[model samples]
Target: SDQRTAWLPAFLAYYNARRPHSALGYQPPASRIPGNNLLQLNS
Candidate 1:
């Protein structure tokens, strides 16, 4: 459980920041946020 707790936040971060969603036209959720420099770097 401690290990799961430690990794859960990391997994959620990746899910919202890097994983593409079909409903979002295959773009990560972070890409939709304004001024997200990571999006520009990825593109």
Candidate 2:
């Protein structure tokens, strides 16, 4: 049960920061967020 607790944050991060959505022209929401470390994400 404890392991499942981690999924929400992971999923949100992926959904908002990694996985691109067609609505945003296939760009991740994070790209629109100013000052995020893009290099760290690439790694």
Candidate 3:
């Protein structure tokens, strides 16, 4: 759906920023982050 497509990035941003994942050992996306990639995003 077009509406869902538009909202996808936003959803991913939050998912990769704040959402915790059981696959990553019950850690928030931030904790599971590997390095400075996320840091670079904010800059």
Index of the highest-TM-score prediction: 1
Model 3 TM-score relative to the real fold = 0.51
Q: What is candidate 1's TM-score against the reference?
A: 0.68
How well does each candidate superpose onto the true structure, as a TM-score? 0.68, 0.63, 0.51
Encode model 3's per-residue lDDT on 4-36: one tens digit a residue: 999999999888877878998867777755575
Which ranges in model 1 have alpha carbons more than 4 Å from their true place? 36-43
Q: In terms of TM-score, how similar is model 2 to the real structure?
A: 0.63
Clash pairs, candidate 1, are: none
**TM-score-better candidate, 2 vs 3:** 2
Candidate 1, residues 1-43, lDDT tens digits: the string is 9999999999999999999999999999887877646566568
Clashes of 1: 0
Cα miss at 41, model 2 (Å)?
A: 21
Ranking by lDDT: 1, 2, 3
Q: Tens digit of lDDT per residue, candidate 2, span 1-43?
A: 7778868899888999899899999999987756756666566
All candidates' lDDT scores?
0.88, 0.83, 0.79
